[model samples]
Target chain A: MNEAITTISVAAGDSVETLFRAHYARLVRALAVVAGSQEAAADAVQEAFVKAHLHWRRIQRYDDPVGWIRRVAINKLRDDHRRGGRKERAVERLKADARPDQIEWSNGQDVTALLAELPRQQRLAMALFYVEGLPIVEVAAAMKLSEGAVKFHLHQGRDRLRGVVAISQEQLP
Target chain B: MSEFDDDRMERLLGAAGGAFPDVNTAYAQVQGRVRHIKQRRSMIAGTAACAVLVVGGAFALGSTGQRSNLQPGDHGSLSVDASVDTQSTPATDDTSAIRPSTTTAGSGAGSNGQGTSSQPTGPSSSTAATTTPSNPATADVQTYTCAGGTITVRLAAGALELVSSQPAAGFALDTSTATATRIEFRWRSSSDDQSIRIDLIGGVPVRKV
Candidate 1:
């Protein structure tokens, strides 16, 4: 973490422009890991900033605006996926697993293709938990799921990823 | 151990995530939109002021020296009291004479047949209303545009006209003032709304007040 990050712990007196520049990159990266597409992640973060600005004066009084923004960004991501359809819902399930395979591959290299192989929910669970490093509570808030459900999705997602990646590796070697 | 518990996995995902683009430009884009919205709000405000002055000048000239008998709900009318803070600079209208499309409302006159014949027709049904100029925003016409739509207002002829530039997805209007009449038209796809004001200055539209 950069020295500037410690300042994020307490959100007082920071100009919107300054806070935006400092955390924008990290937030995008975090969202991209769960969003599956760079463009979607960027959009989600952008929306978060807008919402943050709307409530900036009041939010500056909080202990951590970054966390508040992240929580909001994650929720936005979940809402977008929900609006997309059943397939998207499944991917969100996978992203909760906190597993790396659930999130890697947006270089247009075959990440999406690989991800397509897992149940959407499992894939989403893995991506959010492992790639984004968000706690289950935060993930639940972002995913709009109960903690028990997130746990279930993560557990099921890890098993599924283990199965798929193992089979693929065996076939490769 | 998890299948993803490997350094290679972290490196690959980390690099890919790191590939995410800078959000400053995007943020700036939204900020630019905010600024543009502010400007449009001022313009709409200025236009609104112009409308008021134009309409008010006509009203003042038409009724020259008569005492206003405006009472509460005398003819099913409502009142609008606007209070604008001076902290935000008020908008002024540069174009005073050119009003947007004003259409005549052909509502029937009362049995007494006084001055109720030329009442402005709109979505509101009640008549005989007195529209006090939105001080600061003492105009009869205002215009607003956004990615979703374009709205133009002309009050002297007593109607608000709106044109959608793009198909609308949805919309909503929650104005506090109930004194002025309102008419709304919508298509099926746009959702954004911009604000512009017209101000009446010395019987001629002026720039931001």
Candidate 2:
């Protein structure tokens, strides 16, 4: 890994280095929400960006290269989950490793548990709509679902989260 | 009202994704992987070019009735093509090749079918452009709902054509050239009956070509 060199060559507005810097952390965080583990999320994003770099010569030609990167990274995380129980195992590790002092713990295991409980597309809708700050229409666009479907997922995701969080709070107090 | 409708739920959902450590090392880590993949890419490209040269030479020899070295009965293309592929990835090779492993790992990825699609054992990555054998009849088919439109590429039937795009909400797969994004480009390799098919999505090569 080289030091962050100021990219001397800029073709148009999008550069590989520029995209990486701007979205690397954001992608890691967003995918952690989807994949439920910071390490795995980072791994997926790193792998995705590596592909982006591999195809950068042509990828830079796209209208939304960063969006393409995001889609690939998210799909990688999704595929990682589909491949096996790695993310679930990671979550179990999260619960066991919770120190009550860490940010994940502060955020509440219930959040992770509930997020996992949501169906895949619904979770994706939540991640894009809330975590990544994409508007509803854009979230629909990103997920390749209809705007009605996006709204549906959002509604279902919120309804599920509310019910679960309320139950968690009652048990806490 | 939905749970997320409330401010408390909003705060929690917004904070769902946790922070990562050592943010500074991230770009470096990604860059390191990029370098590794690119090196491997160049190696594949070089090996493929060499294979083409060898195959071309053998074909030139076999055409002449007196070209004794090539087996008179067996076509030169098949034998040479097999040899070329066999050299790239040994069946015993570990799954450490990250680019192919990453590109072909899941059921759905936009492109890079060019390299490391070990299942069919055809050429991959940039080498796909040059390594189309003529004898392959198998069709690799897949349907993906990308961005706005549904993109499907069915290979071997004919020319690279868009199967269907309804509402065509987003992304376009144009086979006119290699630089097309949101479009899947299918290239048929020109080695007689043995051909390689490559699918590129958003300018990234997908499963095979």
Candidate 3:
């Protein structure tokens, strides 16, 4: 996150507004890639931030407060996956039947679709590493994986994405 | 070859990220979610409070309906709460607990030794109760009960005497409103000097009282 940082008194329970201002959009975009839908990602991130606001006293003391928020959002996505299959199926069905323009297609390639071929942990590592641009330790913290595991997933994820990138380039119109 | 790969991979990843539509109302979403959480918590608190009140109210209403045990020798120990009037002497072998006294044939209207100061020496109301000869006509009188005590309202002969657990204070017939099948009266006691009216409905009293 090379975004500008405004200098102010940093304290626990404070900076929620500042943190939201800086990272809310980027968090939503990154989570949308992870969740495969803008709608679900927005909802998940909003709820996670709501939780963060409640526990801001503790959360703001963390080394990476935005990383904590991302972890919460990711956990929420996982929970929705486990609890209700109907909503997940409905979203997939909507995407399948929705109009072409209604869908957000990358001009180059769909990185999430490409990452879908990788293992879940590897895909998550890549998203946190590249899309959200978190460090290895932060990614490990967010994923609740060890730093070494994050490194391994990142290595494997990059190796897989390399193949995907070459293929998409060859298929270019 | 490197992280975020400056050439082909970077461009591909950036394109994918760029495709994500901007959500302009991020703060609005946070506010909405926070409000929703607060509302859900309050609703749960309100439901719990209502349940407690309902349970406590039911307990209070039920607690007073118990018939107190007052033996023959316990006359001096009789204590009456005007609110509950829960204190009473238990019915002896001579008095059937289930079969309440039901006398409605004749009261020569002469000897009522325990008459109230309100109608002093006119008719010994307590004596009228004792002179009630046990007869089959006892089947005609109906007993109505409330939260406080039982008031046996009977239209016997031409008069109505609402003999309560307390002999001194109870309802008397408002002769102007007495009918063959129904009886209406204006009763006034000390603590509850409010005029009482009992509308006998299907052998039970059901009203705002």
Best by DockQ: 3
Q: In CAPRI terms, where does candidate 1 land?
A: incorrect
Q: Candidate 3, which CAPRI tier?
A: acceptable
lDDT of 3 by residue, B41-122 (tens): 8999999999999999988445423212121211111222231122122121111211222221122112223323432122
- Per residue, candidate 2 scores C-alpha lDDT tens digits across B80-142 of 333333423222111211112211112223333433443433334223422243542222222
Error of 2 at B53 (Å): 2.5
Give a tens-digit lDDT track for model 1, residues B1-209: 33334444444445545474656687786587667766887999999999999999998554422211222222111111111111111112223222222111111111122122333232121111213344323244333322233333334434332211121235333221112343232323344443233343333222121
Model 3: per-residue Cα lDDT at residue A8: 26
Comparing 2 with 3 on DockQ, the higher-scoring candidate is: 3
| Each prediction's TM-score versus the true structure | 0.46, 0.53, 0.54
Docking class for candidate 2: incorrect
Rank candidates, TM-score, best first: 3, 2, 1
Q: What DockQ does candidate 3 score?
A: 0.26
Segments in model 3 whose C-alpha atoms lie over 4 Å from true places? A1-10, A13-15, A54-65, A83-109, A170-173, B1-8, B19-24, B61-80, B83-209
Residue A30 in candidate 3, Cα distance off native in Å = 1.6
Candidate number that wins on DockQ, 1 or 2: 2
Clashing pairs in 3: B70-B89, B70-B90, B112-B124, B113-B124
Residue range with the least summed lDDT across 10 consecutive positions in model 2 chain B: B91-100
